[model samples]
Target: MKRSDESTYSWLHRLNPDPYSLAVNAALLELVPPGLRLLHYTRTTVPAEHLGAFAFYHRKIGPFHLDGIPEPMQREMMFVIWRIIELGGRVPCAPMGLLMRELAETTQRLKTAGLPFQSLTDRTPAQWKAELSRTWVKRTHAFPNPQTFRTYVSPLDRACKILWFTYDTSPWWQREVWDLTMDPRIPRRTQEPSGQKAIHWHTMEPAWLRHGGMYFVKSMMESSQLAWSTAHGAKNALVQFARFAMARGLTSPRLVQDDRQLRGLMMEFLTELRSTPNYGIRNRDKPRSPASIGQITSTVRAFYAFMHDYGDEAAAALDDDRWDGLSPEYLRFWRPGDIGSSKKEHFDESYLYSDADLAKIKAAAPLLGLPRAEGGFGDPQAMRILLLMMTTGRRINEICMLDARPLTLLEDNLAKLRYQQTKIHDAPDTIFVDQEVIELIQEQQAWLHAHLATIGADADPPYLFVSRHNNLRGQNPYLTHVFRTQLTKLVDRAHLTDAAGDPLDLGKTHRFRHTKATSLFNAGVPLHVVQRYMGHTTPEMTMHYAQTLDSTAKTEFLKYKKITSTATESAVDAEDLYDLMLLDTRTDRVLPNGWCTLPPAKTCEKGNACLTCDLFATDERFLDIHKSELVSLDSLIDQRQEIHRERTGEPMSENHVWLTLRRREQQALSTIVKNLETGGSKPAAALPAPATQAREQAGMLGGQGVRTGHRP
Candidate 1:
């Protein structure tokens, strides 16, 4: 190709082909299978160099590795398209309306597939481009907008226009640009002193950036982009800190707004740094940290980074001393350790709820459509939400993320309160809720439904609690702080105070769990059971609560109390009790290994380990019973196959399950034999005693008068 033609091809390759270059080839080709086969079959090629460059750019733009989208994703997409075509049977039009419908269907298919997708590397870049061209094109515009865009371009515009006005004469991309000058809601442009028109660059507001998972920062620029003027190194760390710590309730977003606290914190963090660290911005190549007074002043320099980058005149205003080297200030906090009036008041609830005060909190966030209930706290979700936490002991995140559906009741008719990973330190992903909590949940769900309906809100986010800050303005989507803000208001109104009647001692989500553990322990329920109910991941954590419970002793005494109360029980003498003596194996009396081989009870006579003595001793036939049970996997497999053959009239393919069971059975037998030797057990009527349990190793029976599976 000629240089000019090759250059044009380069431009075409660099160009995003959607809705324009894609028009060169139709979006769909009839009678072709949906995916890569279709892609490979249709699109044309480019040079290897061009393909490599394109691949590099794709990676640069995204987290794309050469691996592309996964195979399962491709298969899923194919299956969906195949199914859609099989049912509907044709390429619908490719215009804006149909294009949108096709894209939506494709997306829905991808979602239902629930698989990672393949990327450009799966096919050659040239072939990928060709496919993109063919798939995105061939659609007609729904209506001519005269601005040259269609009726339905994505609400997220395809093109990003820089506000730099001097670029008007400079070569710029016009293919994806749209004319938004007609919209009144958008900023109106004016001529600059340079006699040039400038497109406006708007400021980014504070929002909780929602993305999935943890990964390392990409570049200094990306880190800086998180905050308006954060030092590049501080950016990613700050983002991570905000996400992880805020979720943990260790930090709050309010920190960003408090200038004094933030400045002081920055100074304190700087003071901790004795020397320069590798992550620095000035000498990008060198590994060092800033140590001079300017180390703190770096925050000041970053204050206007965004405005400067955007060519905004407001950048000049940032030079003010408010962010300069921190001024001396007092560290007086209301918490006890800090030099302030009161310590952090914990939840005590000593403030007696007046007969009237109880009525107010319950009435604060009232039911929707109830008469004389003015719109104050809005929905009753907040109040009922608090009750659900305190009563049910669910984590705040679990409650916040709960779906709008009624609780899922299982076969036992017990309602389940399964939650995904929540903010609680170690709360389990699923919890089967108590019965009373289920009723509370049902009532809460009803209240939310009515409230959402009145407000014309759909339960889109599946959040149990909604707030003005987090929810859509009207018929929109959710924001992050909605539940956090709502709960704060509820706590303030509820008069939930500390033991000392301290006003600020409101409870958090975790406090409910703490209360539940305390209550359960106090009620004499076993700690292990509570741990299971609470879904503790480890027994160690469970023991912490278990230590508080004296249920075992309390229950024994209670049992005796009942026994004494019943005069009829006196008829059973001590002789009758001797019949039920299983030889108490409580830890104190049981040998170290939980058995008794010594006369009376095993005590280390040598002050040595039990291995030294094997003297024939058994006050037992107690725990060690003559177990002749044979768990034969081969027999089980044969039996299973016979049943299967009889039922299905097909031969058995493999006995993989039986094989695994047989190995496990052998392991269990070995463990049983080993434990017997250690306990010095003299078991009764041993294996091979039963005709059913006889193995080839221990043939029928020996010449002995008694069955001789036991080693005497």
Candidate 2:
């Protein structure tokens, strides 16, 4: 063989003179790029090279023996090395030779023993597990440390998956099953290794329907109309519809173009959805919940609507003209009333943690980060994230995706925290946090810095709460599943129980949001303010989180007596008023400054004239407002009188419509102030009659003809 200094592989000719070794070396060199061949074959110590393209450093290779290894094992080791180099992966070289030798020897032995194992990629997960057990049992010395074996096998598993799934070259939408992890559009912060990330489109029948479904889902994701999880759900719902359609031989969209046929088909699908068990492995035998049925129907309806609205685009994108078969009937295939309401009449308050329960949980919070040997789950990040959720009422993803410098300091130990509102688009993301929260954040930052330092990372990580392991430069945030697991352990350790004495379920971290919102609402925080704090786009969403406590409602209602427009206390008892108005369940009766005493069945004759109406009532809580209104009324009357004097030689007549109305309003306000100031204990006879009543009596007697009675 000839040697050339220009080629990095020239030194490979010096390793072994055999043709097989040279051929294997040449193939390995071809697999690796010239830029990555930074060292020669004779060099045992690998030099550190910073690969700017990959944004990572190729660290020094560990010591390993290459002599006396079989040629096939040698080729496998070289392939592993070149593969890691090609993919820009970081796998230490020392274990590469040993692991490759073990695998090669195992394969030969398995083949000789007629086990029929060709390669790792060909083995099922169960078969692979059995092979690993057999390998460990046969050669315990080769893998003394289980962790070392895991470390060596991890990269090989990834390589096999990439080969088997074609994850590198194939587009996710082109495959029958789309893995969210392979989709670049998905936000990395929300990605997880576990859970239902794979969306199976192969289950949908008929090639056209399947293709159209894929196009619809991809378009929805691309347009940001739905999240990845929501789109996955939509796909699942479409699969159900497809199954029904296929079974009935209605495979083509054109077959259901008629309104009556489509309606009938949808009705049948709804019936099947209601009767059939859930599609997944977990709840395969259980009947679908009403909420699930509603969601399925709604999603299917949305899919058809999308098809109808974007038929031309779908036809162009899918390269098929059949998409034009969708007619106007597809847009209205399911009526609004066809989908039953999924909302329950009674809310389950068990999800909320009361003050007592919170105290118990807080007392047990210290057990979260403790080591397993110390009788606690070793997860400090979970504890910190939990505390943040408890204080800020942020969504779990928001808390998990917090930036390294999320806090902005204001004056006087107050700070504002910014979080990523992952669920809602264009929602407010900042909330004022107190010193306690600030301190917790600072502590977390310090811990993260120290952790990064220990891992030889020089810069700050992108996220505040980072994953514990396999996080290159702490790029990935802590997984929500880990937090949930830690919380479950904490609940078990604390022996916490719900009101019903069952084991408390802290699995739903969102309950923290509900608990905080309810606490604020019951503490008299305004709904709009809570809405902003909770990062909700609407008050209705915030209200869903706030469950008003009965005690708080009754206490707030009975805080003061309800006085009538005549400055006399109402004849109805406070408790009776509470029941008659149903203040606990109704919000329409609540006024800005007081409560309206009008019965629900009766309509108000005086619209904005509440001050002069007999049905109006107020308490000391609105005393300041009444006084301010009185001052404004007096100023208005003086201004009008001055204008009248300017226009006429004499002051305006006392019976003038405007003057009479102002005086009546003044009398009502003054009477209310006096009643509120005197503790509202005076009898009705103690206060004089309102000016409106006197004017009404005068009008009835043909004096000035001023009409002061309620409108008929």
Candidate that would win on TM-score: 2
Q: lDDT by residue for model 1 over 511-530, one digit each (tens)?
A: 55665665566565675677
Tell me the spans in candidate 1 whose CA falls farther than 4 Å from its real position.
1-376, 411-413, 423-427, 451-481, 490-496, 543-712
Q: Of the candidates shown, which would achieve the greatest lDDT relative to the real structure?
A: 2
lDDT (10s digit) by residue, model 2, range 1-712: 0112112111112221122333434455455555444332323344333222122222443334443334443444445544544332445554444445556556666777887533333443334545655776687645347776665454444434333332123445656656543344443333333223567666568777788888888878777777766777788888887888788887576656556687777777888888888977767889988888888788877877888888888888788877765777777766777767877544555557867778877777878878889987877788888888888888898898898899999977799999987777678989999998999999899989988766544366678988765454466678887788888878877898865578778888888887888888766688899899988898878777554444335545676688888888887678777776555443455554455667767777665567787776777766766776677677778887898999896899999998987788889989999879888553432222112233233323122222223332
TM-score of each: 0.31, 0.64
> Local distance difference test, per candidate?
0.35, 0.65
Error of 1 at 313 (Å): 43
State each candidate's clash count.
Answer: 15, 0
Stretches of candidate 2 off by over 4 Å are 1-99, 102-156, 163-170, 183-196, 203-206, 255-259, 280-284, 546-576, 579-712
